[model samples]
Target: MNRKNGITVCIIAIIAVVLIYAQSGISFGDPVYQDMDQYFLLNGQVQTGGNNICTDVVFDFRAFDTLGEATVLFTAVMGVIVIFRRLMKGEEYEAE
Candidate 1:
């Protein structure tokens, strides 16, 4: 198919998927305070021993998950920088 038709099909598919996802009601992240209980059970308390359950869950039990999430954010930023750099380099090469 031509470029325009391919782009139109992709956009339609993306919109359909997004609509389905929105209707599914599945949530990401801490939905409620009770969600912390599972984390507490899996990971033992240390510095979070006497702290509130939610705090313990957030700072202690899910520490690595949080760290990985932060790493992902950092990676995305770096990726954006690399992408922009490549674009700029291409422009410079074209200019030269």
Candidate 2:
């Protein structure tokens, strides 16, 4: 097969696999452990002293995880900016 047909076949195969996986009995957004959910619902406010349980869980219980996510996002944005800046440096552009 030619390159374009080969690429199209690969993409269709990937999509078919994804559709099959989605149809499987895997559950999304379902908590595996009920005890942890119960503990969070019961003592989340008392331990964190936060009115919003979701906010408390993110900012307090999972602070390090949240920080890591933010760091990764910031690094990705910076890397993209650096790459674009280098690419644009060779071209003439008007600055406002």
Candidate 3:
């Protein structure tokens, strides 16, 4: 490798190592800010009137997000249908 490429790779490796080491305090399956979970577990059923916490979280607290996802998926499907409508109209796809 060229000297310039080697220097760039070394800088990148150092930066990556520093960044990873800096954030090594973060752990999976346990978080720092977790009051929201306790709130949900305690009051999800009472406030949202859902017997299931999973359903309550998905449908009550995150309804707008779920709706947005459904909207995006519907729009994508509609777009694909529009694009392929020509083939649906008595047309044949041929391999060249």
Could you say which candidate leads in lDDT?
Answer: 3
Give one digit per residue, the lDDT tens place, for model 2 in 1-96: 899999999999999999998767668777567897788889999999998998988999889989999999999997897678757857854454
Better TM-score candidate (1, 3): 3
Output the worst ten-in-a-row residue range by lDDT, candidate 2.
87-96
Instruction: List residue ranges in candidate 1 displaced over 4 A.
Output: 1-52, 86-96
In candidate 1, position 92 carries an lDDT of 58
Alpha-carbon deviation at 27 in model 2, angstroms: 10
The lDDT of each candidate is: 0.73, 0.87, 0.90
Q: Which stretches of candidate 3 lie over 4 Å from their true place?
A: 1-19, 89-96
**Per-residue lDDT of 61-85 in model 3, one digit per residue for the tens?**
9999889989999999989977887
TM-score of each: 0.39, 0.56, 0.65
**Top-scoring candidate (TM-score):** 3
